[model samples]
Target chain A: MANVFHQRLDELDELLVDMARRVGEAIEHASAALLAIDTEAAAAIVAADEDLNALQFRVDDRIVELMTRYEPVATDLRFILAAVRISVDLERMGDLAKHVAKSVLLRAPAPAIPDSLREDFAGMGQAAVRISEKLVRVLAERDQMEATQLGLDDDVLDALQQRVHDQIPDLGYGPQVAVDAALLARFFERFGDHAVRISHQVVYLVTGDVHLDRS
Target chain B: MANVFHQRLDELDELLVDMARRVGEAIEHASAALLAIDTEAAAAIVAADEDLNALQFRVDDRIVELMTRYEPVATDLRFILAAVRISVDLERMGDLAKHVAKSVLLRAPAPAIPDSLREDFAGMGQAAVRISEKLVRVLAERDQMEATQLGLDDDVLDALQQRVHDQIPDLGYGPQVAVDAALLARFFERFGDHAVRISHQVVYLVTGDVHLDRS
Candidate 1:
């Protein structure tokens, strides 16, 4: 019975890990669509979000079921709770990607952001996606070191976001353009922060410690 | 033994209710300070935030302890989870209030906002605070009707925020002032949305239904 229960738990873990990976892919694809102004890719990211949301619901159900049926204790209980919270963060990340895609569709044909700003946005997007990927791996392997490293990477994204803000006026764009740039920068910064949150959850899962130099 | 456990749970609920009231009061006081540009009031609000944060930490710890100690089931489990989430929302509302106070301090003695736009901003702040207060009451009584009404009130705040946004450029402020006004509008809109979220949680707690009329 214990072996069977362990197998079931592993299966649930696999499902959640796949969902997190897909969320990261959606974020990256949506960023690409925004940069290329590709309506098709943007639409695809938007449509894919329903699947992510459904997966989140299913994962949550599974976690609750495990808690009730298996009565997991100690580390097992922590893992299940973390899984539920991480699923929420992942679902929100997917929603944020869809929001970015919608913004892309709103400004179709005419580029609201210039190439210089676009470079910073893309860099921030890639960093965010990388953090998400690293988070899944850390959770799957219970890797404390990689999880800690992901937290550090967030500072890089924050610095880049600050530079993007500083460059907004120098971009010499109109009011609407400047506003869009500022909002987009904010989105990227928030995305990075959410990624760090996931990484923090991973560290908690492994070490049973919630505080990790929040500075 | 069961009676003792029930009594403890009731105490936890009372503490949570108290925290919710404190959070609402903090937002209300902070908003008034911002509109009046009262630095002393803002400072007091900022100082009071430490108490809110300390209460939040205590509440979180108590919840975790209760969950681990009693291992509540079904509705009890759901209620505890919802309480945890609502506490987080309340903490965030407190932080938003602090941000508003910081903005007031940054602007100092003079009214940073123009007279023409003052009414719209005051309207938005008042709406946010009122909605927050309603949500706290809904949580205290678990009132479905009050929760739904608060959701509708949030819509009014949203519309007022839109008006503030439209009036931003016409206020004849410099670029920096325009940006600050835009961010201020956004902060109030977010505070309103947090109130809506609290209402949704209340509906869930009362009906065990997560799907609320978010429109």
Candidate 2:
């Protein structure tokens, strides 16, 4: 029989996959809301985030419980520690998606991106979705090569964020519109950051070193 | 033997307190630099933040060492866990301070805050400093009352952040200026979040319950 501790970790793995699925759907809705300014989709994304947070709490509790009960050292302990950090990162990514949704809600009935900059936002939102999808795969497979690809993907998102700022002057919106673009750009950029962090953690789990930042 | 484990924790506490101090100073300089557009102060703030990050690394290493070597359970273990989370929060607060400073550098020799929003930035920056000071006290003193005040202080920051939005239309800046204000206001607000998280961890350390969010 699988030990209770290993069973708990397996349970956590299932929950993490579920959490990632929810986050993917949340960001997709958030992106759609950005394009169409659908307040209902925005609101639904916001409401759906609580489920992610609940999963985070459950994951955290089980990790701490396992640590206390089993006191697993070395590899097992490191795995648990990685779980704690990954859960935090996943929760944070959920919040970032909600931030995008909140941006939509804040400007209800009006699209957050100007028509001229719509492509920029579209690219950003899609990059976020793609990065998270790859991140979930990396988490499950511990694919070091795919993990490296996440770093490369992060660079793409960063360039897109830089492009948003560079194009801001040409877009020529008022203060509120500018604020929305700046914040939305950042929310998208941070989604990539969380994905990269999860990739880093996965690389750590597979290899001994978590120092994948150099790529 | 002075129980090297507790000694390690004590060293971590001292390092964290020092890190908080450094972050407080970094934000203060960042704020002053914002108002004056003082490139030198902004540069100094950016340079100093690396120290905070280093201290965070030290604190984190020590916690894992303690956890692994001593195999502490219950209260001792909980303290180490909280320490790890608190360390992350403090390091992130440092990064927020650096973000503010970088905003200054990116717009160097020119204030990141527009003339119209100077007063708003001043209020936000000062509040960030005040919150960090209180946060350090809560961490050191484990003063629950002090910890609770951070939530109230955070409310003040939230209001200031909201006020920026309300004032945006009247302020009437170009896109770049509006982005600056929105991002800067957010940077200040997130500093409060780190403070509140630290306070919550401190409260959790003391009360054996991490439920300070509702309070």
Candidate 3:
């Protein structure tokens, strides 16, 4: 029974890693769609969000089933709870990616961000993707080292977001473009945030360190 | 043992209700700060968020303890899980409130939002407080009626957010104010979103329905 419980925990980790990978893809694709103003790709990212949502439901169901069948206690119970929280973060990251996609769709045929700001956004997108990739490793390996790196990566995303905000006024874009650019930067910043949150959960699970930053 | 377990569950509910009430106050205070351009009130809201974070930690400790002691199964198990999820939403609502307050602080002595957008923000603030009041009742009583009403309440918030967005471009505010206004509106919208999420968890606990809207 103990071995089986461990195996189930491993299975749960695999599911979380899978969700993180898809979130990374969604972020990458959404960024591409935004940069290229590819409405079709944006639509695909939006559509794929449903799959991530379904996956989160699956994770939740499996968690309940595990608790019902095994009645895991102490560390195992905490680990399961962390999995539930991690899935929420992963699902939210997917939604953030979808929000990015929707922004592209909102300005179809016309680029959502002005060219002056594209380089900063491209940097933000790359930072988001990098953070997500590290998040997948953190989930899969429970590596505290990788988990800590997510915070630094998120800091980079935050800086990029700030840069974008600073540049918006000088670009002389209209309100619609400015609003979209602000919101898009925010979406990427928030995507990195969820990744950091999931990594914090992993760190808590691995090190029993509960100093979570709920910012 | 079962009686004690049920009592512990009640204690958990009380903690959650307490958290909800504080979150409600945070939103009310933050909104007031935003409308008044009261930096002092904004600072208070920011400081108070730490209290909410501490409260969430308390709730989380209680939850882990309950699971450890009871190993609750089936419906009880699901209820506990829902509690975990609901606390997360409440904590996030507090964060959104803090974000509103921070926005006010960012432009201290000068309003973060222009005078023209004040009416819409006022409306958004009122709607947020109303939704939070309903959320407190939903958490305390598990009243599916109040829980369901949250959706409609959030609809009001979404509309208010939309109105704010529509007005932003026309306000002729520079990029900084425009960015701030856009983020402030998004913050309020997200607060409503979190409230709705908590209500959904309450409804699920009451009715065993799981058609959650993660949008």
Candidate 4:
């Protein structure tokens, strides 16, 4: 019975890691579409988000089944609770990626960002992608060190957001463009935050320490 | 055993309703600070958010304890899961309010929003508050009808967001103000979205139908 339970837990981890990887791909594709003004890639990213959402539902249902079947207590119970929370954060990260893709779709023929701000957005996208890659490994390995490092990676995204704000005044774009760019930057920044949040849940699962950063 | 479990469930519902009420107050205070440009009120709202976070932690801890103690299955387990999800949404609504308060603080002595878009924001705030109030009733009474109404209330917020976008071009404000106003509007719209999410969870709890609503 214990072996079967451990096997089920392993399967759950695999599903979550799969979700993390797809979220990274979504961010990368959305970023590419934004830079190239490719509406097709953006539309594909939007459609792919449903798969992430569906995976989250499957994770959640499996979790409920595990709880009902195992009646896990103490550390096992804590792990299950954290799994549900982590899935929520991962699902939200996918939604943020979809928001970025939709921004690309909205300005298909025209770039959503001005050329002056293009480099900053590229940097933002790269930061988000790197953080998500780290997230996939962290979820799969449950490495506390990597989980701690995810917070630092999120700082890079925050700095990029500040850079976008600093450059907005001089970007020479109209108010409409400025607003769109700011929102786009915010969506990426939020994506990084959710990644950090998932890592925090992992840390809690591993160490029983709840560091709920109120961001 | 069933009686005690039902009692604990009732207690959990009260805590969630309490959270809903406090979140409504936070949004109201944040909105007032934005319109009045009152830095003190904004500061108060930011500080008070910690209390909401604390309440969420307390609720979460109790949920884990309840699950462990009762090992609830079937409907009882589903109810517990929904409680945790609702607490998450309510906690996030409080954070959104804090974001609004911080925006007010960042532009203290100068209104974060220009006079031209003030009424749209006012309408947004009122819509958020009404939705929150309905959320409190829906949680306390498990009213699926009121829960369904929340999606419609959120539409009012979406329309106001559109109005802000429509008016931004001619507002004569610089790019910075336009971005600020736009992000602020997005923040409120997200707050409404979270409310709708909580309502959806309530509907699922009452009817066992999952309306994920990929917005």
Q: Pick the candidate with the highest lDDT.
A: 3
TM-score of each: 0.90, 0.94, 0.98, 0.98
- By TM-score, how accurate is candidate 3? 0.98
Q: Which stretches of candidate 2 lie over 4 Å from their true place?
A: A210-215, B212-215
Instruction: Tell me the DockQ of each model, to 2 decimals.
Output: 0.32, 0.53, 0.73, 0.73
Error of 3 at B166 (Å): 1.2
Q: What digit string (tens of lDDT, one per residue) describes model 1 on residues B1-215? A: 56765776776777777777777787788778877889998888888888888877676667666667776676776676666666666776777777788888988876656677788888877787778778767877888888878878788878887787677546565544555666677777777777777678778778778663222
What is the lDDT for A144 in model 3? 86
Give the per-residue lDDT digits (tens) of candidate 3, residues A102-184. 98999888898899988999999999999988998898888888877888989999999988888877878787788899999
Complex DockQ, candidate 2: 0.53
Q: Against the hidden true structure, what lDDT does model 3 obtain? A: 0.89
Return the TM-score for chain B, candidate 1: 0.93
Clashing pairs in 1: none
Residue B87 displacement (Å), model 3: 0.8
Model 4 alpha-carbon drift over 4 Å, by segment: none
Q: In model 2, what are the clashing residue pairs, if there are any?
A: none
DockQ pick, better of 1 and 3: 3
Question: Where in model 1 is the C-alpha error above 4 Å?
Answer: A212-215, B107-114, B169-171, B212-215
